[model samples]
Target: MESIYWVLTWACHRRCRHCYEDRFRPYLRADLEAVVAEAERNAPLVLGNLPKRMTYRDPGGPDLPEKMGRVIISGGEALLEAVRERVTYPVIEGLVARYRDTGGVKVVLQTTGDLLTPAIVREVAQRGVWMISVAGIDDFHVGMEGEAKRPPSRRRSRQ
Candidate 1:
């Protein structure tokens, strides 16, 4: 099934050695109301905030009468500094909670998994939001963050 992806924020706690989205952050991010307003603005022109408009049988056909499948909430790291910078943990929880409360929208979270605390895990579980951890893929995208500086003591001896 198709999914609707949303980048909730650009703030992350880890300055990873391969982060491509490192430069696109604001010093301060939007609050929950702003995020909700933004979500409302781009929402499909249907009741219950459903994605019934994105389904299509043909490339340039009319709207289908089916649901759009799933809603994926992602970011630089949603549960980490993104929540810290923009809204509080509860606010994001509320956002996911909305999708959870919606009968048709299956909510999925794509995150780095470095900051999934037990409390956060419990919250996600309680809200029935599925999570996809992406912490183990840093090596393949090595150049995004460029060469990292190393201390002389820990540096490898050059031949």
Candidate 2:
């Protein structure tokens, strides 16, 4: 397979009008070790098949295909307060440690951006996350209240 989409948890804070995860199987808790083991098992296979190196369209940029296919870690708000430390970070750390030396294995994080604090962002980036894709600013998602009235500024996490 070119990539793996690992849904780390089924727990989300929002009851979005358009989200279907709650309507489906609603087992919100994730099995951290199981998910990590599975990713560890499959990562080598995926990484092995990719080219060792490839030229990028932008010569000044990093290499392609060899550094491109994503192992996207997402969920019912993957970074939800409940499971961020318990499931999400462990999963990311495990996979990054497993594939740090392997080419073409970028660890990508997908979150709703609701609970992403500066500390969490830094922790993930330091742990080897190549990218963080936030899916928060949509009309369907009910906005937060009071202290969390606004999603954390993405710029705050910039290195």
Candidate that scores best on TM-score: 2
* Clash pairs (backbone) in predicted model 1: none
Those runs of model 1 whose alpha carbons end farther than 4 Å from true positions after fitting are 16-18, 22-68, 81-103, 140-159
lDDT of 1 by residue, 1-159 (tens): 356776655555455555576542333445544544443443332223544333334355457445435566666566654353233344335445455534445567777665667877777667656555555234443322222233346556667
Best by lDDT: 2
Q: Provide the lDDT at 14 for model 1.
A: 53
Residue 101 CA error for candidate 2 (Å)? 3.0
- Stretches > 4 Å off in candidate 2: 23-65, 144-159
Q: Encode model 2's per-residue lDDT on 8-112: one tens digit a residue.
A: 655466677677666312233355444444444554565455444321233454553333456788876677655666667777776665555654367889887
TM-score of each: 0.50, 0.62
